[model samples]
Target: MPGKPPLLFDEAFLRKLERLSLVARRARSGYFRGERRSTRRGQSVEFADYRNYVRGDDLRALDWNIYARLERPFIKLFEEEVDQTVHILFDASASMDWPPHPAEHHKWNYARRLAAALGYIALANHDRLTVAALSGDAFTPWGPERRRRSIHRLLAFLSDLPAAGQTRLVPALTRYAGQTKRPGLLFLLSDLLTPEDLRPGLSTLQYRGHEIALLHLLSPDEVTPSLAGDLQLQDVETAARQDITINATVKTLYRQKFDAWQGEIEGFCRQRGIHYTLLTTDRPFETLVLHFLRQRGFVR
Candidate 1:
């Protein structure tokens, strides 16, 4: 029998999470009442501004004190608090299941933990949360659920997700961007090992008005391989093989190419107002969530 999956969060960690909430840079209209302040004025207790009273304005909103002092009726506008929709697009492509060995700091496992932590924060704050797994042509999604009660369901979905198939990022992202009518904060967790150009998909999401944060996951071996001598590397997704001789010069070239690739992605994200963070599997997921994310203004 398969051993039980490790718990994603402990009770103490969950208690700490309850104090934090996902931050949205721009106000968004939400379906249900929540902690986020909306752009629209409503009946919430927080005072927004005062506007000249119009003919059809609600009599209850009239500031009687202002009317008495200035002899002009002003309507009090209160800020509306509403829930935000949070989307976590997790890449469960074959590249994420790197380093093969179970004891290693698996990229897939690390991504899942990050997703779970973010989902928990959203749920705790009563924001609608959706967790989607993207692999090949399939985009499996789970919930637009709100409240702490849904955390278990979110964890379960992520725990059962398997990393397989090629990374079809563009298609998956385009489809998701087209289908989601309401835009909010979107977090993408992926290894991003695909050869496809990601600009089109990212642009589509941005055009649809979603605030995107890309968490680029990588393993230590991928960043700095220790293999030496001539060997054949088989692509896990396509089963394609490549012959290469690992030498000091080759290692230097590989590092340069890798750095250039990462710099390109970061530059693209910077130009498009998308938040990009490179995460290594060896780093503690808790530190990424509680410290790095907070420092980056993602959570508070």
Candidate 2:
């Protein structure tokens, strides 16, 4: 697929796009200005309730008219509310730097475009956004503020992310789960080719009350290994290689294994009520964002 326009991450797109909101099917009751019904109601202009204001409260909301007649300094404070935070966890690993062959696209490039488009969409809609690269050690994951003004910060954070090293999804995810105190939407984008099982990692985040959404990016070659005869398949990240003669039976077995792996992942996500979608690098990112994702309710 052709690469996305660099302007996809521009501020103009965000300003025009913020009107569109993703209707989260699962209950996510934090805050947002959108008219969508929330599971938890709080202090918004929509009017939830009123309580006595404490010290250091905004005095403008004080019921001056009430005080003039009733002789009481009753202040009206709007309920605490805002948009839900959209936490985007992108995988920047060496495996994602896999080269494109023939009609296939680069994995990292595809991921980057998707990340940028999604971030823009979220920011445009007045939703809070946190874009992080969880491929490093338990260090700080940086990104723009949830507001629309932080467009440059979000772009820089994504552009500077390096695609290198082996991925330890469990450690990275567990660390994020520990640090994040608020419950919100979480999207994990990765090829998921780590040596370790990814289930434990995903489960950790899910247990933290996050609406887990997994975007599995796979290359055409990885899904269907077209190698035949004597060949050496080298691990792109580890630099390890295994030499084997590819016969029809071997090819069949590999296909079975690949299918089984995909099935296992799909089953795991379904069982946990997590949203899972697979995207091949060869497909257009716009199609994924505007069509496939909308069908999945990530956009509307």
Candidate 3:
């Protein structure tokens, strides 16, 4: 609790979330009624189809004009609104907690803010929302909270998760997919510096019929190197050290490698139909959520 950062959102920010809704990606029918449109007909203003009126059918739905001409009663059917379950998983790895420099923004904290904002969008739209923390430890999942009133519980759970341990994302995802009875959308926020290949976890989620979006988080130091002289870079999880000098040539190569990595990730996600976005802690998180995310079809 002492090390935890406050969820960086205010009333105005939440108001923005209220204004936006997740892009209407076709999702599986939910267990309970929600605000999103469903395949089945229910009671919305949008008229879909009509059928011969049954004795028990609501009289309000009767087509008076058609009945007057044909001497037959007909009922109207409107599209149903089904709930969507939005599951957001935060990579609580040690690297996420360790910023490359103290002055640099905290990756874990920024990730928390992004996760909270997205979760708020779901709950505010009356969609079922679940936030989960993933590491080598057992997965810690917060509620499938529904509606705006559940925001406090979502905020509380998101703010409390600590970024620690190695990233066992694949195992955690495998377990989750196995247990989940209904399919929904999933947003994964992580640096993705795992020892194992990330493809397996992503593929598993996709195979489970989930619309997956991976928002890869990075720090300014990670995107570029401003350091001079020789230094030892330590791996936060394994404590493994690599000693190197920060020469101009080395820095240039570093930048090139980083660019290449981004390209490879984008290519991979594109091939797999995963909505991949690169987010840096340097820029405004709201810009990514409100502008870039919408542009990429994450929200509308």
List TM-score per model, in order. 0.79, 0.74, 0.77
lDDT of 1 by residue, 172-212 (tens): 99999888877888999988899999889899999998889
Better of 1 and 2 by TM-score: 1
lDDT for 129 in candidate 2 is 73
Ranking by TM-score: 1, 3, 2
lDDT of 3 at 123: 63
Of candidate 3, the 10-residue stretch with the lowest lDDT total is: 24-33
Q: How far is candidate 1 from the true structure (C-alpha RMSD, Å)?
A: 8.6
**Residues 105-158, candidate 2, lDDT per residue (tens digit)?**
778766766776677666644456777786754534765355556666776766
C-alpha lDDT (0 to 100) for residue 10 of candidate 3: 61
Looking at model 1, residue 95 earns an lDDT score of 83
Best by TM-score: 1
lDDT of each: 0.75, 0.67, 0.72
Model 1 compared with the native: what TM-score?
0.79
Model 3: residues >4 Å from true position, as ranges?
6-36, 42-80, 100-104
